[model samples]
Target: MTALPYRPCAGIMLIDRHGRAFVGQRMDSTLEAWQMPQGGIDPGEDPLAAATRELWEETGVASDMVEFIAAPDQEFFYDLPEDLIGKVWKGKWRGQRQRWFLFRFLGEDGDIDIATPHPEFRSWRWIDPAELPRLVVPFKRALYEAVLAAFRPYLNTQIGIEAVSQSDRPR
Candidate 1:
């Protein structure tokens, strides 16, 4: 029997003082949607460590500047593209089991630099939390919603007027 494949991953949701979150547009890809900075957990690396590394590698934010808020209790799954499925990584499963993190950005907006070597994102911007649902990939929307809900309490309390009256505003 073939062994089952499982890979661990980590992601960071960096929130700013204006109650906005950083979202990156994938570089060199046709799909133009945006998402949080994330990457696979290296062998023997803890989830938090991996999240910190990924945040810096992808967004140019120093690991020490952001405060960790929470980690998701569950993992998210998605299928890999068929063309590169087994060719890249030696795993039977194509997707990853991810642990997500929420962080408050302690640095200014000028600190971000997506143009570093081997850049993961082509561009990034501070976007309103309410706009995340429409900008993220559909399959990952639920997980993003859950992560946002989990970190809601720690997010900056100064919400905009529009978000206040909406009953369905993310927690």
Candidate 2:
């Protein structure tokens, strides 16, 4: 049998003011599954643009609410499990080859509206970047880890931490 090709995709890491990453509970999963925004890239679409579009479609976050931060030098890839190889995506693809982005969320929590025209998530929340791998499906754990690694430098910066006035700090 011929090997199946990978689907071109884009992934998003939406980081809020508190330095937490957005995670959504997939409407299609029965397990305690959660993941960041991701989707197949449209034909002839730019990967970065596709990432912005996916972020909005899946999370209801508008472009104004996000600022693009950075992406890894290399895209990440993952394979579907044997049982799912021929069931998902019409079996046209074996897995996804994803280009990921780190976007800083500039809007308030109320800005998020998951009831998109085609909602992929049932619910969502912000999570620590370190916990992303544990939150996703086992098959995609490595992918999540790589994403975290790629964004590690940004995660450590003061980008997501809430600031306090000097008076508010413990003296």
Candidate 3:
């Protein structure tokens, strides 16, 4: 029996000041839903570093404009179709164990440029946090919910401030 191969990865759930989270629409494909920016960790690369790199690569947001808001978390045990196992990438049966980070975007929204040399997302948007569970892939819905719940305090703080500020502004 062949041993199952596993890969370790990392990702970021970028939240903006308006209490919205970033969701990237996959390009050049038929998928209907969007997802967070994520990628595989290079050998010897730290999970945080990988998450930062992926955020920049996929969303055009630099690490300098974002702050690390939490520690690592894991989502494991995803099974790929048998035919796609070796064909997509050289791996056996095991799935990715990912560490996710939550980042607060400090840069202007216009700074996002997915049209870089190697684009991952064709388009991106800031969506409400409550909508994330329905937008992400079904297999990843639970993980997304967990991440959102873990980061809810930070999100709520920002949201409250925004509401107060908006109400205080002149009409």
Q: Which candidate wins on lDDT?
A: 2
What is the full ranking by TM-score, best candidate first? 2, 3, 1
RMSD of each: 6.2, 7.2, 7.4
Pairs of residues clashing in candidate 2: 17-160, 18-160, 19-160
* Full ranking by lDDT: 2, 1, 3
User: Candidates' TM-scores?
Assistant: 0.79, 0.91, 0.80
How many residue pairs clash (N, CA or C atoms closer than 3 angstroms) in each of the candidate models, in the order given? Answer: 0, 3, 0
- Cα displacement (Å) at residue 169, model 3: 34
Model 2, residue 171: C-alpha shift (Å): 46
Q: How big is the RMSD of model 1? A: 6.2
Model 3 scores what on Cα lDDT? 0.72
User: What does candidate 1's lDDT look like per residue over 91-116, in tens digits?
Assistant: 45566677887777888888888987
Q: Name the better of 1 and 2 by TM-score.
A: 2
The C-alpha lDDT values of all candidates are: 0.74, 0.86, 0.72
Candidate that beats the other on lDDT, 1 or 2, i.e. the better one: 2
